[model samples]
Target: MNHFQDYTNNRSRLARIDASLFFAPTSCTPLENSVLWIAGCRPSSFIRFAYALSGLDIQFHLTDFLEGKRIGDLTTQQMTKFDELQGETIRKERNLCSRLASLQEDIVDQPFASKIFTSKNYEEEDHHYQFENADEALDEHSQHMAGVMEEADELRMKTLKQIVINILEPVQAVEYLAAAKRMRLCFQQWGKKRDHHHSNKLD
Candidate 1:
């Protein structure tokens, strides 16, 4: 496949999640921006993960703001604040993902390796070819990487607290938290399944 097709295919995946970052024009490729969306995973799964992390209402509308529609439920002040915090959370994640991208350089754009079930030897080796010397790079970027990940995590929590948790009734927040936890499991499983499919594709 041509480089252009690969880029379009990758960007289309992220756009589905509303998780797509300021892309292409950035120093990184589109696939680099979409590290959070593992190859072969459905965009809905990533969206579910994002929804859970943000603690937004089960039916929370992301495209509402993107489409320039005023959020019917939020006051003008509330909508503006939500946009600001939400934007901050997304930026932090994009920053962290980009920082972590280098550690994953070899994972994408490599020829697929066949899964050899005939012998268990492949298991002993890195079948996925991911994260080779990731630690060294992480150590090299340690200072910058550490702060970026921490800021991303903290900002997500802060935004979630302000826009969703703090505004919700105590009982509702508890229920939402429980549901989010369940959704997290689903997201993890979806990621694993996608990874397996990706492995096949590479082969």
Candidate 2:
């Protein structure tokens, strides 16, 4: 019951933070800019994010399990099962990462910029690039990127759900999810403070 209550409270707090993220300002703050650069403003980053979260989760779980064992709340058998699940999860995430990378490479190989550059007209050392069909090519690229992003996001959600449902007890799942949310919220708050501090320094 206490665990459930902690999960519920954390879940509510996370929900509020999520809402704030959704309504966050359009203009990129310093932190947002860095995130965009690292994430490449792409949906494929979802897989990477999931992989990172899983790593953190595994670390936390291992620490907790060690403590539980000391307190006689967890058994070696449970730890063994967790080890197997963790291995499987890492393998799956790596496969997905490889597949996404390949798809992104395919998209990049046939860039719209190439199409526009190849259509360049030159006369007497004067050159002008023709963008004929460039828009159409760009649109196609956008569609492909959107599709990949959607696929990545779906996989991320599915993987997380599977980990929670299959590998964790109900209470443990809730607590793990709550902790993940709290981590994200802390990062968000910290980023905002960092940005504010920088802005004040510039003033």
Candidate 3:
């Protein structure tokens, strides 16, 4: 029966591939080009601030990622704060993407809802009612999780697309998009293999 493994696997893989595309080379690209990668990130802004503190040199200091230096060694507070700020930056980027291209639209188009609800009908008559109730519960949980993941995926993809477009211009953006699509397809195959492996374990 159609389920996450059968149907929604493709989209989930796409999301991961998108994230990797954006994140993998961002740090090593030329600073000017990388600026586009960090356009709305808190960590980027924080790093910039730190760069300024270090006299705007190309080299970044460890102190930049930290907050204050009251005791000589790096404090957990600094690391945690840096992580939090970075997280906020990602959150804002995702939110902006939602407004810009309606990422939610694509996310909602995934076939998980229909698959989950309809697949339960295949249950034998004796278990049909029981399966129906259980399926409804599963569907509810899946829907909620899918909504969240979909939003996150859209944000990640948009961010990656925007960065690649900025760095490579229109032509390269198209190529990158194509690559991202292929990567997603690969992810689907990977997920199917994994799901099958897990299913075998259960059997």
The most accurate candidate by lDDT is 2
Model 3, runs deviating above 4 Å: 1-161
Candidate 3 lDDT over 1-203, as tens digits, reads: 12323333565555343433333334333332333332222323433333333333336552333332111222355445435544665677556555534433533444434443565566666655322344444455445444545554444444443334333345434443454345345555665676678889999
Name the regions of candidate 2 deviating beyond 4 angstroms.
1-78, 106-108, 111-113, 119-130, 201-203
Worst 10 residues of 1 by lDDT: 109-118
Name the lDDT value of residue 146 in candidate 1. 41
Candidate 1 global TM-score: 0.38
lDDT tens digits by residue: candidate 1, 1-203: 14424554554544443322322225433343355332222223332434433434437653332232222234455446655655665665666667668535533423212222235424555664232334443344444334443444344445556644544445545544555555445556666677678889999
- Higher-scoring candidate on lDDT, 1 or 3: 1
Cα RMSD to the true fold for all candidates: 15.9, 9.2, 15.9
What is the lDDT of every predicted structure here? 0.44, 0.48, 0.42
Q: Which digits, one per residue and each the tens of the lDDT, describe model 2 over residues 1-203?
A: 34534643553444333322322335545565566411223233332333343443354453342332211233455456555655665665566567657755764576644654453533335555545565565556445444444444444455465545664567656655665555456567778899889989999
- Pick by lDDT: 1 or 2, better one: 2
What TM-score quantifies how close candidate 3 is to the native fold?
0.28
Best by TM-score: 2
Which residue pairs in candidate 2 collide?
Answer: none
